[model samples]
Target: MWKIAVGFALFAGLALYILSKGGDIDMSGEKHGADATHSEAPATAVSAPAAAPAAPAASEAK
Candidate 1:
């Protein structure tokens, strides 16, 4: 049991060390795609249709 625990600890430590040294790690959880940094507003403005006014609902009179 002790041997297994030690082995697992060592393996985890080694993996963490290697990952820390690697520059490709992205911990920010942000998208790294080419268009990820661009604003969505401009694209939506260009392609979006104009909003139409809502129609008034008919009232039911007794």
Candidate 2:
């Protein structure tokens, strides 16, 4: 029936969306580790150490 087909299509779409957003992809491996470590070296030197902005001192407020 058309209703059954529609229901099945809806179910399939929902399942695919759920799985895609769930981070099911596995990227952990030796190559990934090597790439990360290799890329991090120069980045550390190029990027400044990030610091939180100083908050307004309490006494400064009225």
Candidate 3:
């Protein structure tokens, strides 16, 4: 129905307006080669450090 079309248009407009207000909005579609690089570099995955030897528990008084 025409109502559906009008609702879709309004929703799309609101979405576009919100995206425009954002600090970063890339509407240039897909990219390739060097242009595909993201602003932030992928974080290097760090291996967790090995745990130290556990201390021996003290004996309880008899």
Candidate 4:
């Protein structure tokens, strides 16, 4: 029990120290509605390779 308390204190202190060094830390937890951010990248249109010409029939070739 004592060990768990000590470990939690150390972790929390370290987390707070790091967060303090970094400005404007949002500790408000998860956001909702319009406050949420959309991390999805914009879609891109890729042009597919052109199809090869149709092969000639065996009878027509002969």
Candidate 5:
């Protein structure tokens, strides 16, 4: 039937499109394949906070 042929053609076109652009869909960071871990340093050490507190808290009631 013409409908079946059209459907098959559409599906083939969609498959080709997906296959062509599929590589860009992957997340570039921290993939298990062939790439090293995200950071050079060990995970155990914690990084210090960069931003200082804006204002000190007032504990005493007015």
Candidate 6:
């Protein structure tokens, strides 16, 4: 029982240590020194297509 408690304490301590040093780790999944803001244009702006001209009326076609 004491061994199990000691093992758990050690594991918890290691986890806390890793978390404390998390700033040194790049967990952002982005390339190092890359600008996150300029990675890509806005989705709405990119996906939208240019507006087409209005169709001519039947009388106007004649």
Write candidate 5's Cα lDDT for 1-62 as tens digits. Answer: 99999999999999889878886443455566656544455569778889986665576534
Evaluated at residue 60, the lDDT of candidate 6 is 97
Looking at candidate 4, the ten consecutive residues that score lowest on lDDT are 34-43
lDDT of each: 0.78, 0.76, 0.90, 0.91, 0.74, 0.78
lDDT accuracy of residue 19 in candidate 5: 78
TM-scores for the candidates: 0.42, 0.39, 0.52, 0.43, 0.38, 0.38
lDDT of 6: 0.78
Please give the clash total of every predicted structure, in order: 0, 0, 0, 0, 0, 0
Which has the better TM-score: candidate 4, or candidate 6?
4
Error of 3 at 60 (Å): 3.4
lDDT per residue for candidate 4 within 8-39, as digits (tens), equals 99999999899999986677899999988757
Could you give the candidate ranking by TM-score, starting with the highest? 3, 4, 1, 2, 6, 5
lDDT of 1 by residue, 1-62 (tens): 99999999999999999998997765666786683675435644456788999776667433
Q: Can you write out model 3's per-residue Cα lDDT over 2-49, one digit (the tens) per residue?
A: 999999999999998899889777889999999998898789999999
**Candidate 2 C-alpha lDDT tens digits along 1-62:** 99999999999999888879987454466664436555234444467789999999999977
Better of 2 and 5 by lDDT: 2
Residue 20 error for model 4, in Å?
Answer: 0.4
Model 5: residue 43 alpha-carbon error in angstroms: 13
CA lDDT, candidate 3, residue 47: 100
Q: Best-fitting candidate, measured by TM-score?
A: 3
| lDDT of the structure predicted as candidate 4 | 0.91
- Candidate 5 regions off by >4 Å? 24-62
RMSD of 5: 8.2
User: Sorted on lDDT, highest at the top, how do the candidates line up?
Assistant: 4, 3, 1, 6, 2, 5
Candidate 1, residue 45: lDDT: 41
